[model samples]
Target: MPDFLIVHTVLVTGAEGQLGRQVIRKSADQEVEVVGLSRLDLDITDLAAVRKRIAEPVTVINCAAYTAVDRAETDADAAYSINETGAANLARACAEVGARLIHVSTDYVFSGTSERPYEPDDPTGPKTVYGASKLAGERAIAELAPTSTIVRTAWVYTGVGTDFVATMRRLEAERDVVRVVTDQVGSPTYAADLADGLLELAELAEAPLILHATNDGATSWYEFARAIFAEIGADPDRVQPTTSAEFVRPAPRPAYSVLSSRAWGAVGLTPLRGWREALHASLAG
Candidate 1:
């Protein structure tokens, strides 16, 4: 808590999600009043409901997003409705109530063609429906809630449940060789770590309008899988590296989505530990 100026109640949307759950858990240790709402509880697309729920001044962290990348190709309406319209509703509500809005975004907003890490002000050319919708949402929030913060993250997993890290663990037990793509590279952000970082942002009185956050460092999917296998006492050698062309999907995954920590550090904000160290700690439990 450290006597940060955040004295208002904190409301989190998408309470059942990986990030939302971690935010709730992290909030328990901090001196803050938090109320978490799931999809069933608060449909952000319903503007009337949003206005009713957020009638007072409070800090709102929005984790609600339609994140099915492949499905988003055919379900553009649903993706935009949730990711864009829903986010706009929250931003509008926050502005009316004088609440601080912190919305979670994805790195898919980029075209994935850059060699270096993505900066917040980098040119954006989303290549998929999902990315387009998220980018739209980011823009809507910026226009509606001028003082809000939009944080774009990549390759997030909690190491438990149905996330990529958990799937890797399941595959390690089910098969000897797990083939993963080598061309796709991004930051691997542990949900718990991301949650801690967001809470830290909440404590600040002011912050950049848009910023990037993730566990430090980057790696390809193949290397990340091998690291996971090694962490769980499995044979890392059994993991095979493949290419994106071999396994096509409805959505064109970004080949490079690593986000830069330069803006994050420049704001005097705390950075999450390196990816490997966080991965080791995630599997330790």
Candidate 2:
């Protein structure tokens, strides 16, 4: 390693999660020392637990979240406790310990009515309980840790996790056709790619307080499903396109979840590859 390479200790919350697992795996060859903590190991909702577990001089990567979109509608309190309050707890703990915080957020923070992609400073109008709670967490971290970095991504999928790519692959094996919503659009991000981006941000001397990091380009759910099928050597025609109204869920999805990466480029970091390339690499791996 170079003399300038500061090998900081990194504490990863939600270590068992898709993105967190990737972060841990990628850090194996890097200069950083990583300590992964699952929900069982550290209950971030408990402030004392956060402070006790995160007392070391480290960079904290908060991948823990209540990610069940539809379930959050009925379980609003549970979602808030984890997503909002838990985030605040981690922020406060990091501040006390003088650790840098990198909080992972979602594109759901926007209402998705904009014709273009959303900027980091765009006005937020979340449409669901999950989105609202995540936005609240972002606010809490911003207020508590002024130097913390908040990375908002969208349509994240991983090979091992129960994400869109895995779901489509499973459905392709099980059923003749898989119906996907055509109206909902966003950038699809592979977990490994996202992990790399976060680690890059961690090494920066100074980064934007808020940044958007996702695989480049945009596509609707229907298109994304078709690409996934094509990558797996399955019949793309079997994946059918339907509007959001046909399959109504408890949570309202944004019609457009695409986020702009201009801020990401402005900071002098190379943007991630396009969604199609990332999807192929993830499935192949």
What TM-score would every model get versus the actual structure? Answer: 0.97, 0.96
Write one digit per residue (lDDT tens) for candidate 1, span 150-237: 9999999988888889999999999979999999999999999999988989988889989999999999999999999999999999
Worst 10 residues of 1 by lDDT: 1-10
In candidate 2, what are the lDDT values of residues 1-285, reduced to their tens digit?
677865688889999888889999988888888889998989889999899987865899999999999999999999999999999999998889888899999999999998899999999999999999999999999999878999999988886658888889889999999999999989999989999988888888668789999999999999999999999999899999899999999998999999999999899878999999999999888
Candidate 2 regions with alpha-carbon error over 4 angstroms: 1-6
Residue pairs with colliding backbones in model 2 are: none
